[model samples]
Target: MTQPIIKLNPHLFFGGNCREAMEFYKSVFGGELVLTLYGEGPPDAHKDPKANSEEMKSKVMFAKLSGVITLLASDNPNNTEAENTGQFGLSLEGSDESIFKGYFDKLAEKGQITAPLIKQFWGDTFGMVTDLYGVNWMVNITANRD
Candidate 1:
C-alpha cells in the first residue's frame, strides 16, 4: 500500500457574498480565480426547489484561488450568517520573514489587528489579524537557527 499525500486547505462558507470576497482575495493574493455560481453548479444545486437559482445565479457556489497556496470557499446553502468569527483561522508559515510580514500587512489593511507582528517566545515573528473578508489569519516565520 502507498501512503497518500495529504494537505490541508481552508474552506470558508459565506452567505451570498462569496464572489465579492473571492475577488478581493484575488486582488490581494494575485491568484487564478476559478469560480462557479449556484446556477452553474451540479444538477443537485439547481434541483433544490428551495434554492433561489435566479437570484443566486451570480453568487459563488464554489471558488478557488490557486497560486503559491490554494484557498477555497463557497456560498452557504442556508443563507445564514456565521455565528461566530472565531470559528477558525488560517495560519500561514513561511521561510522568509519579510515575505511573511508582508502578507500580514496586506491582510491587515482595513482590518483589525488582534496582535501586531513581533518576536514571540518561540523566537519567531508572529501576528494575528482579522482581514477585510472577515477571515482570521495568523502569520508566522519560523525561527532562524543559523
Candidate 2:
C-alpha cells in the first residue's frame, strides 16, 4: 500500500513587520520571496474602514518564502496581540551537519541561543535558537544509524 504525501508548513503572524521578518528569512534561507500587500486586494474586501487606510494598505497581506524551506506569514490587520511565546518551535532535521549548523549560526545572529549546537548523547548535533522575530527553531543533524 502507498501512503498519501503530507507536508507541514509554518505560518506566522506579525504586527506590521511581516515584510521585514520575511525578508530576513529569505536572506537566511536564500529562497524565493513573494509578498502581497494589503492594497493589492479588492477595495471592498475588508468591511473595516481602518483596513483601507494607507498604513494598512502598505502592510503585508501575505508573504511566502519557498526554497530550502517553505514559510508563510502575514501582518495582523486587526492589531491583535499575537505572539509565539514558546508555544511551539519549527524543527529541522537532516544528515548534513554543516548545513544545519550554518543555519543555526545564522539564525542566532541577533537572537538568543537557548541551547548550543553540540554532539548529543543520542549521537547527533542538536541545538535551539529563538530568532530576532521571536520565532523558535530547532536543528538536529542526525547521525548514521548504520
Candidate 3:
C-alpha cells in the first residue's frame, strides 16, 4: 500500500467575527474568500435552537481564504472569547525578503510587535507579531546559506 499524502491547514475560531477576520486576511493575502453563515446552512443541519437567532445566523459558520496560503476559520457557536495561550503560532518562511517584510509590516498594523524583523545570528531576518485578531505570526526571511 502506498502512503497517502497529508496536508495540514490551520483552522482558527473567532467569536462572532470570523467574517471580518477572514475578510482582513483576504485583503492581506489577496485570496479568494468563501463564507457560509449559520443561517445559510440547511435548516436541519443546526441542532441548536439559538442557531436560528438573527445574531447567531449572521455569524460565519465557515470561512476559507485561499491564495498563496490557505486559511480556514469559523465563528464559535458558543461565542467564547478568543484567547492566545501562547502555545503555538503560524510561521511564514521564505527567501523573498521584501514580500515577507511586507507581510510582517501589514500584520503589525494595530497589533503588537513581539519582535522586530532583524538579522539574527542564524543569518536570517526574523520577527514576531500578534495581529489585531490576537493571532500570533512569525516571519522568517531565509538567507542564502551557500
Candidate 4:
C-alpha cells in the first residue's frame, strides 16, 4: 500500500446510520454535501469494478464536501461496526462566538444538550451535546473572541 497525501474526506462507518450521521456532521460543520445515493452515481466506486452495478451504486459509496474543510463520509463497506462514538468524539474548536454559537444551537437541536454554552471554570465558552443520532460532539469557544 502506498501513502496517500492530503486527506480529502474523513471516512466514518456506521452500523446502519451512516447517512444520518453524515447529515448531522454537515449541519454541524460548514460544508457542501455531495452524496452518491445507492445506485444513483457512477459504477466506479466499488473496489471490484466488476462488482460495480446499480445495486451497489446506491450504497453511499461517497459523500464529500469542498469548502473550508473537505469532509468525506460513507457507509460501512458491509459488516464493519461503527466506532464507539462515545469514546471518540468530533470536536469543533474556534474562537468565534457567533459562528460557534450558531453551530452549538443547531447541534443541540433535536439532541440532548449536556452543557449549555456559558462561561466555564476554565474561563472559556464551552458546551456539549449528543445529536439526535446519538453521536457525541463537543464545541468549545475560546474566551478571547476577536
Best by TM-score: 3
Show where candidate 2 strays beyond 4 Å. Answer: 47-50, 80-85
- What's the number of clashes in each of the models? 0, 0, 0, 5
lDDT to native, each model: 0.80, 0.88, 0.86, 0.69
Write out the backbone clash pairs for model 3.
Answer: none
- Worst ten in a row by lDDT for model 3: 78-87
Instruction: Specify the highest-lDDT model's number.
Output: 2
TM-score of each: 0.87, 0.90, 0.91, 0.69
Query: Residue 100 deviation, candidate 4, in Å?
Result: 0.4
In candidate 2, list every pair of residues with a backbone clash: none
Task: Please give, for residues 78-132, the per-residue lDDT of candidate 1 as tens digits.
Answer: 7645433567898999879877887888889888899999998989888999987
Q: How close is candidate 3 to the true structure, as a TM-score?
A: 0.91
Q: How well is each residue in 69-141 modelled by candidate 3, as lDDT tens digits?
A: 9899998877646665356799999999999998999899888899999999999999999988989999999
Candidate 1 yields a Cα-based lDDT of 0.80
* Pick by lDDT: 2 or 4, better one: 2
Better of 1 and 2 by TM-score: 2
Model 4: runs farther than 4 Å from truth?
A: 1-9, 37-56, 79-84
Worst 10 residues of 4 by lDDT: 49-58
Show the colliding residue pairs in model 4: 38-57, 38-58, 38-59, 39-57, 39-58
lDDT of 4 by residue, 32-96 (tens): 87887656645574576533654444466677766655766666555345455565566777888
Error of 1 at 9 (Å): 1.4
